[model samples]
Target: MRVLLAGGGTAGHTSPLLATAAVLAEAGDDITCLGTPKGLEVTLIPEAGFPLELVPPVPLPRRPNADLVRLPANLRRTVKATLGVIDRVRPDVVVGFGGYVSVPAYLAARRRKLPIVVHEGNALPGVANKLGARLTTHVAVSFPDTDLRGATYTGLPIRRQIADLDRDALRDEGRRYFGLDADRPTILVTGGSQGARRINTTMAAASRDLAAAGVQVLHAAGRPEEVELDRRAGDPPYVVERYIDRIDLAYAAADLVVCRSGANTVTEVAAVGLPAVFVPLPIGNGEQALNAHPVVGAGGGLLVEDAAFTPAWVDSAVVPLVTSPERLAHMSRAASGIVRRDAAEQLAQLIHRAAQERR
Candidate 1:
């Protein structure tokens, strides 16, 4: 079967699509990724050894005047590019993960009468996914409570390496790889893939406090600021990195995690059963907060508002958990309860069924 997957703009949107593509490709299906030239997909898709078809960057307008001026032109360009790609590829099915890039591809697929499936990876649907849902025959979701009508809770598709890790083996490997004392608890801090300035700064300020309390920190800062923070931190027990390629290793290594509440991050955290302190990005209609609510409500993690996130709060809230074995263990169990490691395989099965029905 030939499948066309489209999504981009950030790693949050693209990574899951890539994971799904990897599964489909391994199963002997032909896959081509369509995305904007400027998005993270340009770098990531090619590196994954797949064909990437570039479309023009279509900016979603924020203001009415700009929307009126640019909407027609942008739609026309998007339709042209999408139609051109579809004509050449002639994919049997089109699957969109969320982003502005997905909209045109979904529309184009509808025009061609191809089967369309959309994966909504957030608790609150984005404009693109909302539009795509109407055109799609199936809507798969990461969060169970997403308001997309007729959507199924398929969980988030994660990389096979992560999905397949044995919990006990992961814990053992994590301890050895990071050289943790095994007795002392570890805290994993990340600002998502691009890194969060607020999170980084807050962590930097709280690093010494963490060290003094005997907490080992593995921080993925996502940029120079994190590296600088690492340099400033100095010595063993505290590790800092600009980016982490082996996220499975990080997840396996961490006892407690502090991170953004992006859909993928939450799913990965749940998959690995690591407890978290989530500071959702305070932007774009409070979607991150919406994503965190389920985990927080389930007692898997604590949701700290961006406005309330501070070194003092981190010390007060996270320090006690890191220092106390009983609390940390309890939270870990709570986290494990939320993860669905077989999500990718399950989603793939659904897609396969959908494709077959379309044929």
Candidate 2:
């Protein structure tokens, strides 16, 4: 099968799109990605060894202005460019994950009368995906009860490492890899690729308390230099790094995680059955808050608002949770049941089915 995937703008959209593409490519299918030049996909897609076709990004302005006035013409040009890519590739199906690029790809696919599969990775469907879902019968969603037509709960197509993670089995090796104690409780703190300023600073301030509690911390501070902080010397339990490429290791080694509740983070954490303290991004349309709602409701995690997730809260709440074996075990069990392990494969099957309909 020849599949053309359209999604970008952020890792939230692109990560799942690439995960699905990886499964298809491994199964001997030809895959091409359609993304805007400005998105992370420009580098990530090519690095993943897939051909990426560029399209102009047309973001819908929130308020009426000059950009709003230019929306019609921009959409026309982007749609034309996307159509050109579709015609040249002659793909069997075009799959869209929600992003600015998806709008044009969805429009082009419909004009060509091609089979379309839309995946909404958030609990709240974006404008691009809401529009795309109307043109296709095949719709997949990460969270259940997403407000979209004909949506199937496919889960997020996470990276193969996360999907296949066995925390217990890899715990020792992961600990050794990170130079953490094999016996002590481990906590992983992260805030996506760019790192969260609030999370990094708060985690740093609370580091002494966490270390005093005999818990090891793996803090993937996204911007280590930007924040003026220092790791305590003398065999410190707090291991701080600018970034961690092998996040699988971090997950395996962690008994608890303190991080942002992006769709990918929530799904990946749930998939691995790791108990978490999810701090949803304070901005946006409250989608991050919605993303972590199910997990927190299921007792798999705790949701903390940005303002409340302070060093004081960490000392009062997080310290006790990490030290309590019984509570951690219960949260882990709750998280373990919420994920579908074969999301990537299932979505690939849907893409194949959509392609067959075109025949």
RMSD for all candidates, in order, please: 2.1, 1.3
The TM-score of predicted model 1 comes to 0.94
Looking at candidate 1, what is the lDDT of residue 119? Answer: 93
- C-alpha lDDT of candidate 1 relative to the true structure: 0.84
Estimate the TM-score of every prediction.
Answer: 0.94, 0.97
Residue pairs with colliding backbones in model 2 are: none
Q: What lDDT is reached at residue 85 by model 2? A: 97
Which candidate number has the best lDDT? Answer: 2
Q: What's the TM for model 2?
A: 0.97
lDDT of 1 by residue, 1-359 (tens): 99999999898888899899998998999999999988899999999999999888677766677766887799889988999999999898899998879888888998988888899888989888888888766899998889997798888898888777665577767767766656567888899778898888888888777777878788888874643443334433777788888778888888789999999899888777778899989888888988888778888889999879998998898899877778877877887778577777777877887788667
Per-residue lDDT tens digits of candidate 2, residues 239-340?
778889899999999999999999999999999999999999999889999999999999999999999999899999999999998999999999989878
- The runs of at least 3 residues in candidate 1 whose Cα sits more than 4 Å from the true structure, single-residue gaps closed, are 65-68, 175-182, 226-236
Candidate 2 has an lDDT of 0.91
Worst 10 residues of 1 by lDDT: 227-236
